[model samples]
Target: MRATVAGTAVTLTAGALLTAAMTTATASPPATATTPPGTTASQPVLVDCLWQRTVRPIDFVLACGDGNSRLTGLHWEQWSPDKATAVGVNMVNDCKPYCAAGKFHSYRVTVRLEGTEPWKKHPGVQRYTRMSITYADARPDGFKQVMTYPLWG
Candidate 1:
């Protein structure tokens, strides 16, 4: 009986000490840095474009400009609400060799939305909405360039 009580007391004492040590170690320091007066976080610019009948279901070819020359044959993906997982290929014919330290290239994509009878009543009638493109070198876990484009009248 005495041995069992001593063991229980030792275990309880160890647990109490561990709890106290964790509480002290996990305590956070008070805030120190403050933004200057009248400063605020900048907001991202939203890109919205009007949808035209002819613009529906279109293809875009993008060029990679190295501040002077245009590089062709670069590939990219277009994401939209109409087709959630559509992959469009680039049809660039003349492309220079891939350069590591050149200016980043800009791409254009063509999107197509099938016309629906009920779509006419919709304000934007967005057959598709471009979401984002994941660069080839992007981390597989959770890295991608994501943006939303809203269609407006």
Candidate 2:
């Protein structure tokens, strides 16, 4: 899939790059706080990002209002009725310029979504029970010891 990643036009192809040297994220709930209110029974609800950079030199940040980390692009490589696997890029904040103005650097990541549970806030709505993020590429600076970030925060 060809999409914009940090303003860089990066193609996420399913192959060795996705299967090799991958970091599987731990199981966790979805970002409930970020999930919009009065959500219906929507299949694959897309999370809205605060910002997305151009893909020329690869510079974009997708702030889903989670406030933990931003991402570039997420493309589902394999998805089924039971589970889904996706490949994307995350830009961890580097407290540069200032904490609020921190810049986000790119890192390849693999995300998995599985398990379904009813949405407590809204009845008749189901959301992913667990979402995981594994470092698919080299770890960014300041994240040497960390491999995955909580799917929900």
Best by lDDT: 2
lDDT of 2 by residue, 1-153 (tens): 234563353334444456553533223333342433443344433222321111111222334554546655777775443556777787777767765887767788876666755444444544455556678668666554334332221
| Global lDDT of each candidate | 0.35, 0.50
Poorest stretch of ten by lDDT in candidate 2? 50-59
**lDDT per residue as tens, model 1, 1-153:** 999999999999999999999988678431211212342212111122322222212233222243232223333242233343333432333233444433343333322222222234343433333334333332222323432333322
How much RMSD separates candidate 1 from the native structure?
17.8
How large is the C-alpha RMSD of every model relative to the true structure?
17.8, 18.0
Q: Looking at candidate 1, what is the lDDT of residue 108?
A: 38
Among these predictions, the greatest TM-score belongs to 2
TM-score of the candidate numbered 2?
A: 0.49
